[model samples]
Each structure stands twice: as structure tokens, then as C-alpha cells.
Target chain A: MIFPALRVLVPVALVIALVAIGLRIGDALGIGPDPAFTLLAGALFGVLLQRSRFCFYCILRELFEDRDSRASYGLLVALAVGSLGYVAMFGSWVADPGAGRLPPDAHIGPVSWVLVVAGLAFGIGMTLSGSCISAHLYRLGEGSVLSPFALVGALAGFVLGFASWDHLYVETISRAPTEWLPARFGYGGAVLLQLAVLGALALLLMRRLPARPARDAAAWRLRAVLDAVFVRRWPAWVGGAGVGMLGFIAYFRTSPLGVTAELGSRARTLAERLDLIPGRLAGLDGFSGCATVVIDALMTENGVFILALVAGSLAAAIGAGAFRPRRQPLHRYPLALLGGVLMGWGAMVALGCTVGVLLSGISAFALSGWVFGAAVVAGVWVSLAVRNRVRMRLSARHPAG
Target chain B: MSTLSKSLRRTAALLLALPLLAAGQAVADGPVVSTSWLAERLGDERIRVVEVSVEPGRFERGHIPGAVNFRWHTDLVDPVRRDIASPEAFSKLVSEAGIDADTTVVLYGDHNNWFAAWGAWIFDLYGHDNVVLLDGGRDKWQRENREMSRRPARHAATDYQLDVAKPELRARLADVLEVVEGEHRAALLDIRSPAEFEGRIFAPPGIQELAIRAGHIPGAKNVPWDRVVRDDGTFRDTEELRRLYADIGIDGSDPVIVYCRIGERSAHSWFVLSRILGYEARQYDGSWTEWGNAVGVPIDNPAGTVWGGT
Candidate 1:
């Protein structure tokens, strides 16, 4: 009883303490109240994420590895809800696309062949690292040993991405189009198009989702809120809806929901300050991609947001008695690190991670989102095949096991 | 309840309640006005709204009820030289637009207010006393679901007199060269993409490369023009803008000359520095087109080689 209570208490106390400390630091640095807002938003994101397990990698792995598409349906639900919210907020632009105006600050980036390559690398990285960037944050909160190594690797990958950005950008990205659907199709047409596509995908995935057992009276009652919050994994649809709502709220209140901006900027700033990278990072500030620049202060809105995400996830995990920290084999650390580097590089090149590029990007009616999403799935397919082949060979070599 | 569980409950409540407790408004009065502010003052005889979007149809389709169209290319530029309209021509345009010396001219547009800022810069150059930009521009108004009208509101022509043009507020190629060579006491800021600044890529695809070579002015610090604004196209608070420029060693100690490919993007930065941050800043309208092509002038092409011939 004491252990269970302590587990819950410790995470909550730590999160509050961290947030308070962050606010104080932000105050000293003169960033104002944005840090507090970001941290709270992050914590909320973490709680929702921990309870739902709404990770891109996990969802994809379930679909491919277990032939279960429930999580895939969850992703579709999220897209559908997010698109509706975007439409409501951005209705004016949607109503009049002839204005030739696109929504400012949306996750839309330039569509190029470089994006496809980046998505593929991101997929491979996600597989090797065992989680996407957001997932890694939440999972790290739950004491996942592999996350630290993956994060470090991602930092290294950002440096690599920064270094190679000039060459790739000059050749491929410079030629690509940054198309918004509402610009080509009217706002109504774009919304209808997204809804139809998402609806069809949901139907397709629904057929593959396994049936569930009947729930008891207590499970259906008001007590279910508590049960769902602290004792059970939320249904995929609920998780998806929650995430979409959060994304909508975050966009309206602050910036669009993104996890990589802080990481990318930090890495870029650190590298440039250390003289490891050049002062001018080409095309980074001009166009909409995972853009990073050095700011005067150490703590940014994104940094606070991400930190709070981890805290929220920790609280949720501990409350639900799911804060399991498992040790990994020493050899796996290297692979995790490599995976992180690839993810970092891909995310930077692509301008966002899975959620940032695919989810938020799509919701904003950008075609780049679809392109990145398709490329990532394709990359995952190829990596899975290669991994399976390697595993088979290794098994054959050690038949005694 | 157990001690741990009780404490956890209190912590959760405190975390949720913190936002409410941290209450203070940062009333930043930049050279900007909200949609509501404009709405309340709309149709007032003294307030004139000028829409300066790149797309021509936007003004035709609908706009902030009574905004006059100020096409950056056709209306704002001089036909003979690749420069802003002559003071006489600008005076006529402003007069035609019914913007007198005392009139409160509010400018707005799309593409993150790129052209709007350009219009504001030209107005400032001509020394307009009361000029302001709509924060977040036309997008913000539309997003707010405010009233829009297709019926153009024409204003009677007024004699818009200019005593003198503020040439000091507008940096020429020569002024930029001085700042670049460190001969002048000013901050030379290149507000272009990193690739463009580093000479990795010339112009973005589709646009003709203005400069014979891809690069930036020497000793000019690169600060991507978009840093001063939020995702919603609205400029950040004054405190944030102050810190961003300060971090890059850009204080109000010396004047700042901002430039981009054609001076449009840099004008946005100029608005931020001069209007928002209240700094002594100017836009180099000649920008890369003049800098990159000029003979005997210095060009810092780090990645690509500069062309030898004209």
C-alpha cells in the first residue's frame, strides 16, 4: 500500500518541483510566463500520451507486427478530429482560398524528394530506437533505459543533418513546391477531401481491429473515468480524440503542437556556439521546416513544453502503477544511439518528427504531411524486412538457444 | 488517506492552479493594432486601411471593409529605376489613397505581412506621421470572422505633402556597403535563409536569381527575417523581440540596416526593430539585387564561387 502511494506521490512532487524551478529560471532569464504555459501543456500531453500509448512507432508496429489496426484507427480518429478543429479555427482561409493566403505558422513545409529520404531514415531510426521522439520522452519518464542513449544519438544526428543540409537543400529541396491543399482546392474541398480519405482509412482499419469483450456495469458507470485514468489503457479512439483536442487547444493558445523544435534548436545552438558548426545554417529560418535558430535565453517555450510532457507522463505512469524501468543489454545501447542519430537527422531534414510532420502537418491541409507519412511507412516496411532477415540468420547460427 | 497519496493530490491541484496564479498582462504597444482595434475605428474619416498583398484578387474578392489596394510592384516602385517610387510619385499615390499627413494609415496584407511591411516602410520613408500595421494582418481578421466587404470604398483625393524624404530611414547600397565594411557605426543584418546567407543556394526555385552570385554581404549577421513573428503572423511581444536581437549582439547602440533578396522581407524586420523594438533601423531596398551585381563591391560567397564577368 505504501509503495503504491509513494510511487504516485514521488512523480507528482518531482513534476511540480521541476516546473517551479523552470519558472524561476525563466523569470531570471526574462522569458516571462510562456514557460509555465508550455510546461503545463507538456504535462497534459504527457498524461494523455502515457494513458493512451499513442506513439507512431507502437501504432505502426501493432499494425505490421501483430496484424492489429486498432491503433491505426486511433491515428485516423486523431487526424479527423484535428482536421475539424483546424477547419473551425482556419475557416476564413478555408472559405476563401482565392485570397491566395495560407494559414501562418502551420506545420506545412516544402515537398521534395529529400523529404521522402528523410522519412525513410526516420522510420529506420524509430525502429532501432524503439520509440518516436515524443514517445521517447514519455517512455523515458517511465524509466525506459534505452531512451537516454536514443536521445544522445538524436543530438548527434541533428549535427549531421545541419552539416549535410546545405548540399541536400541546394540540390533537392530548393526545387520542391510547398503546396497547401486549400490553395489548389478550395477550403471546403480540402476539408472534404481529408475527411473522405481519413474516413475510408478508418473503415479499412476497423475491419482489421479485433473484437473486445463485453464490459460490466461498473466499467460503464461514472467510476470508469477514474478506472480509465489510473487503472486501464484508454481505448484508441478516446486517446486519438484527446490528442486531437490537445493539439487544437495548443495551437490556439500558443504555437502548433510540435516536439522537435526545442531539440533541433538546442542542438543547433550548442553546435554553433561550440564552433563545431557554421554560424549560418542555410534555409533554416526562411522556409517552414523543422527550423532552428539561436535565441538569447536558454529556456524556450518548446523546451518547457517538452520537459512538462515528460513530467506529465511520469505522473500518469506512476498513478497507474505502470512506471516500470527495465534494464537493457549493454550491446543494445550502441544500436539505440545509432537509431537516435538517424531519427535526429531525419527529423531535422524533414523539419519535424512523426507527430509534428504527419499529424499536425496533415491537419493544417498540407500535402507534405501525406508525402512524409507515406515515405515513413514505406521505410518501416523495408527496415522490418531487413531486421527479420538478420534475425533469422542469427537464429540459424545459434540453434541451441 | 495515505501520506503519499494525500501529498500527490495536493501537488496535482497546485500544478493545475499555477496558471491562474501567474497573472500579469504584457501590454506591448508595437507599431501594430489588433483586428478589434481597427474594427472599432473602421469607417472613421481619419483612419485609412491600405491592403498591400501580393495577390491582386484578394483585395478584389474581399478585404477589411474599406481598405484601399496598394500593390507593392505597380504603385510603390519607380518605373525608370529599380527603386521605390520618387517622392513626387509617392505623394500622389498617398494623396490618391486619401492618406493625408494627419490620417491614421493602417496597412495589412498576406504572406506574413511581407508586402504590408513594405508599404509601411515606403510610407515611413516618405515621412508619414501616423502609420501602423495590423497585427497578424488580413489573416487575423478573417480568422476572427470579422466583417469583410467586396465593395471598394473610394476616398476623395487630398493633397499629401511631404516636406522632405527620410533618406536616413532608408539605407541605400552605399550605406549597406559602409556598414558591411565596418566603416559605419551600424549593425549590418542579412535577413535571408541560411542557405542564401551561406551561398549554398541562390534564390528559391521559381524566382529568378537576382544576384549573379549566391552569398551575403561581409560582416553582416544572418537573422532569418521570420524570427520576430509568431506562427500566427503576429509579431512577438516587445520583451521577446528585445531578447532575440540582443542575443545576436544587436542592441540599440548603433543603427541597424536590414536586407533581404528584394527588401520586402527585410522591411518586415525593419518594422519589428523600428516600430516594435523602437530601434533606429532602416531597410536596404536595393538589397541583394544591387549588392550581388555591383562591380568592385565586396560579396562574401562562402559556398558558391562568385561570377567574374558582368
Candidate 2:
């Protein structure tokens, strides 16, 4: 038992120590403390995501298929918490909430039909791939064989997005409205309204939640504590609250909590280098989501954050004994790739993935966020229904098998 | 001393002083300085370093030691109008930035000194006599691992007065229109990317300020601003620059009017033409934004691209 426990504890401890030392060295090198802080934030986020199993697609699917509203509640709680934190930050940053000027570097993207289309595609991609982009990152730590193919597919999708960007920009995105909730209602008003909406949704979801088993009271013991920490999956609300707090802290310290900026930037840089895309992608830079740029430096803030996120998730997964690598069937590879491509293109067009546009956007109280979230939900629902119908028909035809 | 001997002696003295005078003038009036030159004179009281990067908060992150930051949007332009800063505002800005009449202002910035050249143009407009661009600007300095400081430099403020505004240095919309209509003899130089010049795109991706229409002024020669700079962001030698322009019949004999999407990029080209290669040039500060958006301006768009159309 001691040897087995050491196998989990030693690696996790080494990871934490290495992170601490890396932060110190990074600060000493004159890159400033922002990168170090971002690394820490990403690590914390990874641990929370992995331990809580806070996957957007998984939660939504569970709600639709199994009528499990528990994980969905966690997501709502995260949004609510994030929204409250954002309002507080916004209040301090811009005293007059009605001011037309947006808080700098917030994920307030333009609202348009393109965003809806992107969100739908992303949702469908999530369904097909079995994870959202953020989920793929965490699950990569969990040794998901398909995550690599999906990520590669996403890179290709970004290239495709660059190809299609100019026409779309001219048609719709150029004229799209960037709606900030605080601009319409005051900070207090905006938070309250968002909370009310979230509350209503939460109540609606609660009706579908299955009854929980009563907890058996036990005396406090070291073994029990270790089991709870390392063996048991965290409650949905705990993960939701952790995620929300992290999002707030991330925005306050660094930029917004985004995972795809680095990925998109890499794709953009590569595409530009290969001359695969046009020299100019019109209106791509003006609007803020996860704005992609041609690579100038080896390490960007987002790049470092993502690297640390993976590392942190790996540590958590190891400790939880959840880093189980399983061989997937051959056919699932193609689906993962296709799904990744869809998600990549969607994220590129929309300027962010689930974590970037939906989570961060909604927290910042941008109307685009809510629109994206609704569209994503509708997409997931529709795709799941269609898939279920297809499966049923196939099974009906092959009853003996 | 006889009269003949006195005149000969005087001539000899004047001839001896010619090279010395020329060298002194070069030191004082040259429009661009290399990094080593500026680095050697880091703490010289007569020199002031100014950063005018397009990206916000870059100055705060790190800049050349003792350099002051000037935000392009608010500091360089009129807050209320779509124009350069008013005379009074410009005076106040210079005064607050510790610039004086005798100060040799060394300007540098990010994006290969795109906005820094704009600053130089503005300085020229206001007739600052001793201003020079730091050759290669901030990019080269940073790439070479020069020292940078986050601490804001504190310098004693001086009452920096604006000299007579140089009107010939700037070209207005009417001036560009006259050139387009064949009334002016000046050569029209569009310094935007080929895509922008050919009307395939309205503006560079991610740039907010855009024209309603896409294309260049009719008969304008396309030479992207970046053609003047090397990979390291330093300006190419005089001979190369001259050859580049001479290919399009701009051999410095003809007055050149340079323009880009906005005036900033054109200012870079204007710096190259007027300062580096000694050409008679005026920056059409209005540029494509003014030309393309004007109600009935004649434009030569090869791609035939239209706004809101495929």
C-alpha cells in the first residue's frame, strides 16, 4: 500500500516542485512575473479540470442522454461565479459601466450569424470527437489516443478557416455588432440579469437530476482522506466553483482564460509561412476572440499557459490513477480527425473554442457568449438525436448481432 | 602682405574649413542614426528617446532605457478631429515629454518603426530641427539583446515651443486628387501591400480604420513600405533605395507623393524618399483612407473587388 501510494505521491510532488522552480527561474530571466503567474494559473486550471471531470461536452451529453443534471449544474455554477467576478473587476476597471469603451483584452467578440454557425460546428465536432478542445487538452494528459488526431485535425481546420475568412468577413462579420452587457445595463444590473437567467436555467435542469445517495458518516481517518483525494471523483459543484475562481484570477492577473490562442497562432504562423493562405486575412485582427498572430517569439503567454495546463493535468491524472492509456479501434481515428477539423475551423472563425468564446465570453457578459452557448447547446442536442436515430436503425437491421 | 597674397590666403582658409563644416552639418542634421550611435550617447542631455509603438502597453512592458512613450491614437492625433494634433496640444506633449528646442529627439518603435516614422513626420511637420529615427527602430535593438527598462524615466520638463509648421512636408486630399487628375507633376507612390494596392483587400487584417472602397489612386506606382527595410528592419542602403524607386521613373527629379492605407505606413516611405535618398517627397497623410472613401474619386483597382461583394 505504501509503495503504491508513493508511485502516485512522488510524481505529483516532483511536478509541483518543478513548477515552483520554473516560476522562480522565469521571473529571474526578466520576462516578468506574468508568464510565471499564467503557468501557475494554467496548472491550477488543469488539476481542477482533470479531477472534477469538468468537460463541457461530457456534461451536456450526460444531461441529454442519461438525464444526469449534476454535471450541468456544475457548469452553471462556474458561469455564475465567473460572471460575478467579472462584474466586480469590470466595476473597478471602468467605473461607468455605460461607457462605450470595453475593458481591454476581454473576450468581447462581435455577434453575427458566423458566430452561430461556428458554435454549431464546434458542438457537432465535440459530439463526434467525444470532447471539446479544452477537454481534449486535459484528456491528452489522461492518455486519450484520439486527442492527437483531433488536435492535428484542428490545426488543418484553422488553415481552412484562414482560407474562408476573407469572403465571410466581407459578407457578414465586418458589419457584426459587438454587444457588451455592461454597455446596455450597468455592471450591477448586468450581473443580476445574468444570474437570474442562470438561476432559471439551473432550476429547470434540477428537475431532471436524479436523487443522490445519502452519505454514510465515518470517523475521520488518514486512509479515508487519501481515498477521497486520490480515488474519488470530485463533486460537480466543487469543480465548477474552482473553475470559476480560476477564471476570475486568470483575467485579473493575466489575460482571459483561453486555451486556443497558441494553437490558432501556431496554425496561422505555419499557414502564412507555407503561403498556403492569402497574405492578408481581412478583419481577422480587429475583433478580439483568441486573436492569432504570426509567431515572433518561441514562447507566448498562451503557449506557456497551455504547456503548464497539460503538465498540471498529467500530475492530477497520475495521482488519481486515471492516466489509463487504452488502444482505440481503428475506425474511431477518422471520426476524431474529422471532428477536430470541424472544431478547429469553428474556433478559428469564431475566434475561440469552448473555453475561449463560450466560457470567457459569457463571463465577460458579451452577448456573443450567450448566443454561442445557446447555439452550441442546440447543435449538440440535434446531433445527438440524429446519431441516436442512426444507431437505432442500424441495430434494428442487425438484431442477431 | 600684398593684396594678391591676402586673397589667396583667404581662399586657402575657406577651402580648409569646407570638409569640417560638412562633417559638422552631417552630425547635426542627419535624419537617421544607428543603434551604436544612440547607444554611445545614451545619457547625453541633448538627446531624448521616444517610443511610439502601435501596440498598447508595450512601452510599459519594456523599452530602451530612459525612453518616453507616446500613444499614437491619443498623443499624436487630435482627440476630437480626424487630424494631427493641434499646435497647442503638440507643444504641450513635447514640453511634458522633456523635449526642448535644442534636444536631438531619437524616435524608435515596434512594428519596424511604422508609427515611429509617423512621429518623425509629425516632428518634421512642426519643424523640429534636430530629430532623427533610430535606424531599425526598437525591433533591431530588442533582437540584439539590448538593455530595456520597465521603470518610467523621469526628466525635468521644458517649455518646448513649436517652430514654423512645414506645409510642404504634408499632402492633403486636394493635392492627391490633383495628381490623380493629371494637374500635378508629382509621382504617386502607393506603399501598401500588393493585395491592398490591387484592391483585393481594403486594409491589412485586424486593422480597424478602413476605407469604404478598395484600391489605389489612378496611375500610382505600387511599392510596399517594407521594400525599403531589410530583414533586420534597418533601411536598405541609398543605392538600393534609389534603384528601387528609379525602376518606376522616380529618380528624385520628380516630386513624389507617398500614400498607404493610413498615413503611418506612407510616413515610413516618405522618410525613405525624403530623408534617406534625398528625394523631394510629401506624405499624403489622408492616403487610401481618404482617397478610397471619397465620394467619386477615380481609383485603378485591377482586382475589381467591391465592398460587401464576393
Q: Write down the TM-score of every candidate.
A: 0.67, 0.65
Error of 1 at B165 (Å): 11
- Relative to the true structure, candidate 2 reaches a TM of 0.65
Q: Which residue ranges in model 2 land beyond 4 Å of their true spot?
A: A1-6, A13-17, A24-33, B1-54, B57-71, B74-82, B86-310
DockQ of 1: 0.04
lDDT of 2 by residue, A71-142 (tens): 998889899999988777776556576757777678999899999999999999988888999999999888
Give the winner by lDDT. 2
Kindly report the docking quality category of candidate 2: incorrect
Interface DockQ per candidate: 0.04, 0.05
Lowest summed-lDDT stretch of 10 residues in model 2 chain A?
A25-34
The numbered model that scores best in TM-score is 1
Q: Please list the residue runs of candidate 1 whose C-alpha ends up more than 4 Å from where it truly belongs after superposition.
A: A14-33, A93-95, A220-224, A273-275, B1-82, B85-103, B106-121, B124-310
